[model samples]
Each structure stands twice: as structure tokens, then as C-alpha cells.
Target chain A: MHLAEGVLPVEWAAVWFAPAAATTVIGVRKLRSKTTQIPQRKALTGIMGASVFAISLMPIPVPVAGSVSHPCGTPLAAIVLGPFVSVVVAAVSLLFQALFFAHGGLSTWGANIVSEGVAGSLVGAGVFLGSRRLGLSLFASGFLAGFIGDLSVYAVTALELSLGLFGVSELGRQWVSLFGAFLPVQGPLALGRRCSPVGS
Target chain B: MSLRRIATVLVFVAVVAAAVTPTALHRGKGAGDYVGIDESIMEARAQEAGREARPPFINTDQGDLLLFVFTVGGLLAGGALGYLGRMVFVEGATSRERTRSMVDGR
Candidate 1:
């Protein structure tokens, strides 16, 4: 769900900064549980960021659209690094994508970061934690976590595109009138935990 | 053409190609709307609402399934990376010790 440049614009994106900044703080603070040093943490961050880009490179064909949705790599980053570091991983990877792939634009970086970063957190905390608590296998937990992460981002993407400044087209104004209507369809897919096998 | 001129021409071509590619793809879908929604919106809504009242199509079922698959694949790939990183770290640790011992003539 790479937002095209000026989709939501910089002023709107600025609102995302507070959440991302808070996530970063929580991430660094949570490192107390690990024996790893700052250098190692930095290294993990870089590696996870690269993995996000690399995974997206392996295209998944979406035959209906004739264009595939590239992997967001959010859940992967969360699993590799702690869920908290996912915010950092997403923010960094989106930054890189903005510059290199022109996937997301400078003006929309913060918005992309928040939407993606939050998705990673949802999977990391919700599916992973909840399933594991219920004694689900690591593989199942991981699968569910990732499923939630991807759907959450898609819902967010649909929300921002359908209702945000870019808005539904004037021709489709009647449908746009029901902007909030899709929430029911979108929300459960975004949050529901579908059962997956022990290992994906 | 001089190298600089050739480079300029190539850059221009690249930019134009990039711009037109998405347009070409969008037209293929029979979707003219600027906000890029996939075909499902049309399939689900077209007949019921007719073309005039078409909303952005979201095939939540297929979309969710595709999304889950992407995540599963991404996670496995990330775990592999994490595994390799740990291996490289271990190798680096030992290699560093070996170099230290060599320089000291131990």
C-alpha cells in the first residue's frame, strides 16, 4: 500500500510522527531484556530493513488486478527483531523505498510509516501473543501474526485512499457517501485470526 | 550525440516510460479512476449499482488470503536471514579472536 506522492501530503503525514516516535522510544527501552549491545541492535535493524525490501522483490501475482501486491515485510521484521523494533524497521524500509523505488513519496512517508508500523505491532502483539498464550505452535502463531499484519495494512490503505484527501472520485460520489460503510468488511479481515498450520 | 547528451536523452526516456507504464496498466483494467482500486469493486458492485454508482472495489476475501500468504512467505524469509546473521556473527567472533592471537605472536 505504498502511497503515491502527495496522496495525503506532508501536513497530514506529520500527524503520524508522534506515534512512530513513541514506538521508537518503547523499542529502545525494551532492549533491557536482551544481552545484545547497541551495535548488534543497529545491525539487526539494518538487516531487517533489507529483508523487507528483498522479500517485496519476490512478486506475488494478483491475477485480477494484473498487478501484484509486494510483500510489506512488516510481520517478518517484527518476528526477526522484537515487535517494537518493527516500527523502526518499517520506518526505515519505507524511507528507503521512497528514495529508490519511488514507491511511497516523501510527503507521505510519515503516513506510510504509521500505517505500516502499526500493522507490524498488531501482528506482533495480537496474533503472536494471543496464540502463543493459547499454546499454539510457533509456526501457527507466526502465520496468524503475519496474516493479521498484512490485512491491517491493506485496510488502512483502503481507508486512506477511499476517504482521505485524495478521496473517492466525483463520478463515484454516491459510493463515497458510504465511506464508513466498508469498515465492517475491512475491520474483521484486518483483525481476525484465521487458523493456520503449525508451520506456514 | 555526446555522452552527456545521450545520458540526458536516456534519463528523459526513463521518466516517460515510468509515467506511462502505470497508465497503460490502469487502462487495461477498464478502470479510469485515479485512486487505484483493484477489479473486485467492479465485479461485486457493477451490476447491482450499475457503472455510475461504482465504489472502490475491495475483494476482502481474496485480498486477505493474498495478504496472509505474503506474510507467511515474508516471515520464513526473515527467519532465514536471522539465522544467517547469527551464523555470520559467530564466524566474525571467532575470526576476530584468531586475528588477535596471530598479531600477538602467541
Candidate 2:
């Protein structure tokens, strides 16, 4: 769900930027406070950041979509670190990808972060916490968190594209199409992600 | 075990099998079948919306650059994980031991 450069209009990009920046600031502060409380978490955070970076960069093939797609590793990070800190991890990873690999664009960085970082982390963590509260075991909760959160990233990206690029009149149809484009490819990858949180 | 636990295990195994079975069953398929959807689908849709992907500030799409970047990223990730493995894993175990000792003393 890395929206490439020039994909989202300037106004829409800035609209996404506000929340992304806000979350990032809060995430950084939360991470710093946590590190002060538990020094070991600082190193763990770095390792998780690097893991998210490398894991998302790998493109896996899906015969159903007849194409390859990457898995969002934010869920695992969120599961390990807190969700807010996971946002920072994702932002760092997305920024690196944008700068070095040209995978995502600087212009669309806000949108990408909003989709992958904010949406993925919060939803993944929320689902995991919710499942646990409902008395589910660790493994089951992790699997639900990873799978559902992974799918939600694409869903938000599709919504962003529909709102920014396409006409409102055709919004529903375009959103579904864009979301569907990723569904088949992402489903199996999401299944794969189910193991990431628990096995890590 | 309860039927629910057994079912969960079965589903987990099935998912794992589903992920791996395809590659094992269809070895040596055409390379075009594996093109990334980011390029094939996302980019195409963006074009249809009248927006084109511009060249990035540092375009690693050039020869060998992306590969080099991936190699560096992999090394950094591996090194960071290796260096912190003891702190993250061993420390957790040590903490667990400390808690167990405290509880036993109590």
C-alpha cells in the first residue's frame, strides 16, 4: 500500500500528513518514555524497526492475483512493542524505502504512513488486545491481529486512492476495484503474517 | 483438548500448508506470473486516474542499485537482530527466573 509519488493530489497528501505527523510525534515521545522505563526496549525497538524494514521489502508471489505483493510487518512490531511505538517503526521503515529504494514516494509519504503505519499498528494491536480480552489464547489472538490488520492496510489505501484520485460519483466502485486488486494477492500473505507475531 | 482447540490447530496447519503447497506443486512456472502487483496493478490504476509516478529523489530502480540496497538492508537487519538477541530473549528468561525465585521464597 505504498502510494507512489504524484499518485495522491497535493491537498489530499497534506490532509493525510496532519495525522501522520501527529502520530509520529506521539510515538517518538512514547518510545522515549518507555526506553527510560525499560532500557532494554531501546535495542529491541531498533531490531524490530530493522525487521519491519526488511520484511516489508520482500515481495512474495501469489498465483491467485497473478502477481506478487509484500506483507506488512507492522502487526508483529505492534505485538512486540506497543502500537504507538510500532508507528514509529513503520514510519522509519517507510521513510527508508521512500528514500533509498524508491518503493514509496516522499510526496505520498504521509498517505503511505497513514495507511501502513497508523492503520496497521492500531488495528493490529487493537484486535490482539480485544481478542485477548475475549479470552482467546496468545496464538489465536496473534493470528487474528496479523491477518485482519494486514488486510485493513490495503482497505485504507484503496479508500485513499478512491477519495484522492477518482471522482466521488464512482468512489464506491473504484474503491472496491482497487481493494480487490490487492485482495487475492494479500490473502495468502496475510495468512503468512498470522505466524509472524506468534512465532517471533 | 476441546474441539475448538483442535479446530484451531487444524486451521493453522491448513493455512501453513496452503501457503507452501503452491510453490511445491508448481515449480518452474513462467517468471511473468510473479510480477509485483504494486507495479502491475497499482501503477496501472494510478495512470488510469491520470497521475504518473515520477522519478524518486534517489532512483534505486537503476541497474544493481535496488539489489545493493536490499543487501545492505538485510545485513543491517541481521546484525541488529543478532546484537540484540541476548538482551531481548535472554533477559526475558532471566527476568522470568527472578520472578520464579521470588515466588518460591514467598
Candidate 3:
């Protein structure tokens, strides 16, 4: 549920920009840290980016929401590509979605990126690595990575909305209520995670 | 498979789940019930020079229900993926793998 420019208050949107920029910088630093080979890194980043873009548009029917939106595909990106690279991929894909599809607004792209990019990198990759260490299966690790990555995206999306440009609330209550929309869809998704850890 | 990856996943799950509760619960109210752009408003905005003409999501009863289903599915799927991804992708130590192999052998 990407917010458009006219819907939100300008001031709050402005408030979120700085944090979004910082998030992006963190992603960039992450990308820099992993370049054992620059060319491969770029290629991987490109692959990850395109994959995320395609996945984000995968159009899972929102149960009863009556509209289809794609999975952020953050989990797969993070697990396969690593966090830093996933962030960049998510960021670029989101940029494209905003510009071409009008899926989200340009002014809010940074905030959107933070939720989709940084959160996915951190959560998806984090879980996969951690779970595997604890002796979870590879598929399970991938599933966890993706599931968490997506959740992080949703959470970030909520927090970003909570910034409350329309005088919604200082406490972010306005943003908290949107979780209801995903209920019917999340259960099967979780169970399915047991089978497919990776986004595949 | 590493300690770092596990921690990263958990932290991501915890933070997003904890922080974005409000957002997930209360999304798209403005656009949910939209009948479509107010033609008059769109016209007025068009005259105003630089306004974007975009359609809003109509939060019909069917749509709302779908959104709700999606959210629930998302949570379950995300959580399940988290638990299962860890389980499958991370191979266990000797005992755990041995136990499974032994069970399968029996």
C-alpha cells in the first residue's frame, strides 16, 4: 500500500527523507564491503535487482483485498544475494516501480526504499544465516529469510506511514491498523514456507 | 548458516513486526473506498498546472476482506518462512543429522 504525494502531509514526508537517505547509505556501504570481485558483484547486484523487481510485481492476490500486489521478494534477494546487495537491489527496483508503474510516489521513494531495501537486507539475510547456524535446513533457512524479509518490508512500510504527514498521529496509531488486510493471506503463506525456503 | 545470518533474520523479523504494527493494521483507508477520482477535482487539479492524476484503491467490502486475508497470510507465511528457512537451510550438528538419518534408516 504505497502512499501517494497528495495523500500525505508534505512536512511529515520531508521528515522521513533523512532517515531514508541514511538507510540507503548503509546499503551502499554494505555493497562496498562485499566486493571480493567488483565485476561479479555488479553482475550479482544486477541479477538480484531484476529478480526483486520481477518478484515485487509477482501479484499475489491479497486474499480478499480484491487487488493484487507482488511480494517484495526481499527474502529471496537477501538469502541469495546477501543483505547489502539485496538493499541495493530493492532500492533500484523500487525506484523503477515508482517511476514506471506509479506503484508508489517519487517523493516517498526514499521511505519506501528503507522499508523494502534495508529491512529485507537485514532481516532476510540475518535469519537465514542465523537459523542455518542453529542447524536449520537450507530450505527452511531460505524460507525464514524470505518470510522475515517480507515482514520487515511490511513493518517498514507501516513505520514509514506512521511518520504521519496528515496529522494522523504522533504515536503512529494511524499506521498500525493496516495489518488487518493481510490476515487471510499470511497463513497458507507461512505453511508454504515450510516447503520452499527460497522464493522459488 | 552462520551465527551472523541467524541474528540478522531475527532482528529483521522482530523490528519490522514490532515497529510496523500500526501501519499494517491501518493501510489505504483514503484510497480503499474511492469511487474513482472526483472528475471535478481532477479537472480542477489539472487546471492547477502540476498535479498527478492517479487512481486510488477502492476499499470495497470484498477488497477489505482480501486485504485482511493478505495480511494474515503474510504474517503466517513470513513467520513460517522464518522458522522453516532456518530449519532447512541450516544443517544440524552430528547428533541431529544422525538422529534423522537413523530414523529414516529404521
Candidate 4:
């Protein structure tokens, strides 16, 4: 889901910016309130942030695709910390990845955040909560959340890429192929919870 | 050490070896082998669409620098995760028990 530097056009980048920024602001407010209520949670939040940074950036090779791909870490973060707070964690990690690692570019950071942060977190949290409501055990619910949430990041990325690269006209034709490219590697990784008990 | 601790360490080592060994051995062979899907697939598609990925501002792709950064980052994150585990499972559980006992005594 790393949209490298200059991948998205300026217009598309701007299009992604508004919602990403707004969501991040909401995440910040929510996190502040949470931390304020329980000061000890600060440590856990830091741990989650670090985990997101490491997990999302670590590329594992999948023999099926003969290529490596990163796992989105937002799902597990969302399950443990609230979805909004997970968004903040993802945004911060993505920013660091953009600046230091060059995995994603500054220009396309907003789009990356939207996919990996917003969509991943919401879907993960929703799936986990819904599964629990349906009487699924914690492990079962976590597995579903991680698997679906990981795939959702790439799904959203494909949409962004289609819209940004081909405009609105070719979106219907492009996203499927784009998303398909990710499946070979991501499918198995997501099944393994991206090599952790909880992760995308 | 306890059996669980030994097992955890062994598992961690095995996972690291499994992830790193093949890629390290096959270095400089072919572009496709172990290349990130981001570059092999997504970026390729973007290029076909006439939008190219420019060089990053601080290109960590320079000769094992990316690997070095990942190693350092992994270590720091692992440390934090260890602390998190203790906080949530060890200290937090103990604290809850203490609170329960206090309430029962009252």
C-alpha cells in the first residue's frame, strides 16, 4: 500500500488530504481524551505506535507471488486501542516511513494514510466487534479482523490508484487487476495475522 | 531458563532466519526475486499509467541502509512490545488482583 513519491498526481493527493487530515485530527482528540482519563495507557499507546511502525514496514516474501509485501498493522492496533487512536498511530508511522524510509512519499502520504489508517482501522474494529457480538471467541474474532482488515488496505489502495492514475472513467476496469496483484502475497500473510497474534 | 522462554527465543530466531536467509543468499541475482510487490506490481502498474515513482527524498534503498534501518527499528519496537506485555499481562494482572483482594477485605 506504499504509494511511492510522486505516484499520485497533485490533484489526487489533494483529494485524499482533506479526509485524512480530518480523521487524524479526530484521532488525536480521541487519543488525548483517552490518555487523560487513564494516564497509564500512555505506555500502551507508545507500544502500539512502535508496533505499527515495525510491522507495517517489514516486508516478507511470499513464494506464491515471488515478491515481498508489507502487512498493514492498523487492524491489531484498532482492536487493542480504539479505531481513531489506531488512525493516529498509522498516520504517525506512515509519516516516519515517508520521511526516513522512503517507503511512501510525502506527496502521497494522505492517500496511504486513508488506505492503511482509516479504512484498515474501521474495517478491523468493525469486524472484530461484530464477530464478538455474534459470540465468536477472541481468537476467532481477531483472526477475521486481521485477515479482512489487511486485505481492505490494499483494496482501498487499488481504488485510490485507479482513480488517481486513470481518473474516474477507467476506475471500474482498473481496480480489480490492481487489487489482484496484491492478493498473491497479502492473502497468506493476512492468514498468518502478518506473523503475529494480532496484526494486519 | 523456563521452557516457554526458550521456546519463544527459538521461534523468534527461526522466524528471522526464515525471512532473511533466502533473500540474503539470492541478492543481486534477478530483479523479480524477493522484490517488494510495491515495486514489482503496484509501481509497475503506475508506470504503465504514465505516472512514475520518483526517487525518495532520503533514499534508504542505498546499499543495505534500508535493512540496517529496519533492524534498528525492529529492536526498538521489540523492546517496547516486551514492556507492553509485562504491563498488560504481568503488572496489570497483579494490580487487578490486589484491587480485588482489597475490595474483598473491605
Candidate 5:
């Protein structure tokens, strides 16, 4: 789920934006360096970008949480692409969602990117690589990556929201409350993401 | 069993589990609820600080119009990003070969 516009204080929003911008630039450079080596990198990035856009739009209701959230396809994208490229894809998709669908917010774009793009992709990639190093099959590794990646996004998002809303003093308590609320739906969604063909 | 087969079975089971879950049970606060929470908190904070909450820059009420603009904008942006990325990154022999093929009109 995306944090809406005007939800965060201007300073907090700017804080998130700076890092997102830095990481995006880094990702772009990485992509440029890899393009010559990978034959279908461009096509794959485009396809994954579009897929991230579409998949994020499909909201699945989580019965126990009394809430609905969509699966973040970033982990799968990170697996196919790399973490940097996945960030680009996520930024593009989240931008569209914020602008066109009102699903996310313009001011909150940086925060969303940090949570869904950078953190999600990096965590997913790290987990995937770690799993592979453990001699796990590709499918199993991908599953773990997708599952962890999906959950991490929400976890980070919870922290961001709590920080913005409650400030530093009550940050921990607020984050835990919000994160707990998200778990019921996020858990099942993570599992579904892990098991999906794209995730594996 | 092959890893692929195991993955497929896992996927099937997950799908079934998701399908069987009742929508009513999941019918709690949506993301919008969080936004509301932020608004209230910010307002309280503003009151404590003796300041006003910052307003949004854009007209958030124009949902439909924004969606249309964003859709068109997103597609163009994504396409342009992809194209530019290809130009900058995909160079050297493969690019030369593709260019030669096109130039030959074959």
C-alpha cells in the first residue's frame, strides 16, 4: 500500500526523497554499465516495469486484517533484473500509480521508492543470493526472496508512516502497532507472492 | 520431485487458500485509513506546536483527470526511460551487428 500525499511532514518527505534520488542515480549508472553485457536487459526491464505497474494495481483483500493490499512484484523484478534496475522499475510504476490512480502520493514518492524499491529489491536480492549460496534450488531461492521482499516493504513502510505521524518519541510503539495491523494480510500476500510463477 | 513441480503445487495451494478466505474478514481499514490517521496526528501536532498543517500542492480532488494525465505520462515516461537506457547501455558489437543488419535492408 502506498502512503498518500500530504500525509508526511515536508521535512520528513524531503528526508526520504534525498536518498531515493541518490539510489536512483546509482541504479541508472549500474544499468548503463550492464546494458552492453546483457543482451535482453532493456526489453526485460521494460516488461518488468510494466508488470510492476499492473501487478501493484491488483489489490487483494486480506480477510483477517480487514484490509487489502497488493503484492509488490519488485522481488521478482530484482531477481530477473538487479536491485538497481528493480528500483527504477519500482519508481516508474509507483510514479504512475501516484499520478494516475491516486494510489500513492506525489509528495510521498520518495518514501515509497525507498520502501518499495530500494529496500524491497535489495532485501529480496540479498535473500535470493543467500539462498542460492546455501545450495537451494532456484525456485526455492526465488520464493524466499519474494516472500521476504514483500514483507520488508511493508515493514519499512510501517516505520516510515509511524515516524512521520508519531515522531521520534513514540516511533517504536506506533511502528509496531501499524506493522502488526499489516501482518494478517501481508503474510498471506507474501506467501502467494513466494509461490507465484513470476516470484520463482 | 522437480523444483518446478514443487513450485507449481505450492502456487496452487496458495491460490486456493487465498480464494477460500472470506472478503468480509479482510474488510478493515484500507490505505486511505492510514492517510486519515496521519491527518489527525498532524493536526494534533500542529496544535501542539502552534502551527498550521501544510496543504497539498496539487488539487487532489481531481482524481479522474489526474488518473488520465498520469496514465499517459507514465507510459511515455517508462517508454522513454527504456529507450534511453537501451541507447546508453546497449553498445559495442551487438549494437553494431544490429545496425549493420538494418542498414543492409535485410
Candidate 6:
């Protein structure tokens, strides 16, 4: 779930926004460069963006933790579209979510993008590439990519929230607390995401 | 049905069952009571400070109107950008082939 608007101090939000903006620029450049190959890729990107929008909206409640959250599709996007393009897709999806669903806040958009888009995409691509290099089958690599990508998003979110709310002094404790609260729901969601053939 | 088909159906049934059973069993606590990460952060902050920390921006009637405007604007901007990006970058083989064929015929 995205941090609500005004949850983070303005400074912290700005701080996170910097990297997200940078990556988005890079992604756009990359997309432009790759546009010559096939129109299908562009179509795929638009379709994937819609998929991410839909998937992120459906929050399933985890009975164990009494928390509700949705599975992120960043890993799948990164695996198909590359990390940079994935970041753009995430940003677009998140922007719509904030505007339409009130799931995330506009003020904290940067932080959410950083956590879900940047961290999730990069880590997912790295894991998928690494798994392929290690001789894993495509299905196995994709599963790991999606599973770890989902978890990493939450981890990054935990870190961001902790830093914003608790500052540098109590970062560790706060991260753990927030992460723990996220785990019960996130863990199952991640597994389900990995097992689902359509998304992974 | 094949095993794969059976498995898919079973999975679908299980998911539906899981989603419905929980809500049926648990009542009184509103859906919002389920602590999302955003609410959890707010609760934690409020606990430490001994005061409620309200969300900075919330949805209002005016805000919804603004959001609708933004959504339409974003959609237009995204579409324009996508079209421009494709025009500038994409070189379809069929179009190139067609051009070559036309030149050769001429």
C-alpha cells in the first residue's frame, strides 16, 4: 500500500522524488531508443501498464496479520519491459491510483514510486537475470523475480516510512516494525503472484 | 478435463473460497479496520507523539473534481507521448518493405 498523503514530511518526500525522476528520464530515453524494433513492444507496454493498474487496486486481506494489501506487478513488468520502462509504468499506474482510487497520496507519490517502481524493478531484473545465468528455467526465474520483487517493494516501503516517520536515529526498529506488519499479507501475496502463470 | 484444467479450476475455487469465507466469518470490524501500511504508519506515529496525525490531503468533493480533470489530462498526455515516441522511434519492417517495393516499381 502507498503511504497516504502528508504522511511523510515534505523534505523526505522531495528527497525520494529525486531518484524516481532521474530513473523515469532514463527509462523514457531507453524507450525512445528501442521504439524502432517493433510496434508490438509499445503495445505491450500500454497493456502492461493497464495490468499493473488493475492488479494494484485489488487488496486482499490477510487474516493472520489483519492487514490488507495488493500484489505488485513491477517484477513482471521489469522482466518484460526492462527496469527503466518498468519504472515509468509503475509511475503511471501509481499516479492513476492516487487520482482515481485514493490509494496513495499525491504529495507522497515520489516515495511510493521509489519504493515500488525503482527498487522493485531493479531488484526484480537483477534477480531474474541472475537466475537465468544460474541455469534456472524461465518459469523458475520468473517466479523468483516476482516473489523477490514483491518483497523488496515492501522492504523499501518499510525503510522509506521508517526514515520519514522516525528519522535516522530509530530507523532500524521502525523498519522492522513496519515490515513485520507488512509481512503476513505480503508474503502470501508474493507467493500467489509467483505461482500465477498469467502475471509471472 | 485434463489435469491442468482441473488444477486451474481448483485454484480458482480455492481463491474464491478464501476471499468469501474470511468476510463471512469476521464481522463487526469494518473493512477499514484492516490495517494497511499507510494507516499503520499513521497509528505508529500517533502513538509515539501522543496525538493523532491526520493525513495531509484527503478526498473532498472539489478534490474529486480536480482528480477527474487530472485523470483526463494524464490520459491525453500519456497518449500523445506514446504516439510521439512511437513515431520517432519505431521503424516497422512492413512499412520499410512497402516503401522499397514502391520505389522499385517506380
lDDT of each structure? 0.54, 0.82, 0.55, 0.84, 0.72, 0.74
Give the runs in model 3 whose Cα sits over 4 Å from its true position: A36-38, A62-65, A165-172, A186-200, B1-106
What TM-score, computed on C-alpha atoms, does each candidate reach?
0.56, 0.86, 0.60, 0.86, 0.70, 0.72
Better of 1 and 4 by lDDT: 4
* Cα shift from native, residue A73, model 5 (Å): 0.8
For candidate 6, chain B by itself scores a TM value of 0.40
Q: Which stretches of candidate 6 lie over 4 Å from their true place?
A: B1-35, B41-106
Model 6, A74-173: lDDT tens digits are 8888998999999999999888778656677787789889988998899999999997897666876787788778889989998887887778999999
Give the higher-lDDT candidate: 4 or 5.
4
What CAPRI-style quality would you assign to candidate 5? Answer: incorrect
TM-score of chain B of each: 0.36, 0.61, 0.29, 0.65, 0.36, 0.40
Query: What DockQ does each candidate score versus the true complex, computed on alpha carbons?
Result: 0.04, 0.40, 0.04, 0.28, 0.12, 0.14
Off by over 4 Å in 1: A28-42, A166-200, B1-106
**Interface root mean square deviation of every model, in Å?**
16.3, 4.7, 12.2, 7.3, 7.1, 7.3
Clashes of 4: 0
lDDT (Cα, tens digit) per residue for candidate 5, span A1-200: 47767667789988999989988998888888787787567766777777787677666655444445778888888888899889988998888777656666888899999999988899999999997997777877787788878878888888887787778999888778776656656777677666667552
CAPRI verdict (incorrect, acceptable, medium, high) for model 6: incorrect
lDDT of 3 at B19: 34
Give candidate 1's root-mean-square deviation (CA, Å).
17.7
lDDT of 2 by residue, A14-109 (tens): 899998999999999999999999898898898889888888888877665456888888878898998889989999999999999878899999
Model 1 chain B poorest ten-residue lDDT run: B51-60
Clashes of each: 1, 0, 74, 0, 5, 1
TM-score order of candidates, top first: 2, 4, 6, 5, 3, 1
After TM-score superposition, the amount by which residue A97's alpha carbon in candidate 1 deviates from its true location, in angstroms, is: 0.9
DockQ pick, better of 2 and 6: 2
| Candidate 1 docking classification | incorrect
Model 3 lDDT tens row, A5-114: 44344665577677667766777887777765543455455555655665564455433222334467766777766766676777776665665444556666666667
Error of 2 at A51 (Å): 1.1
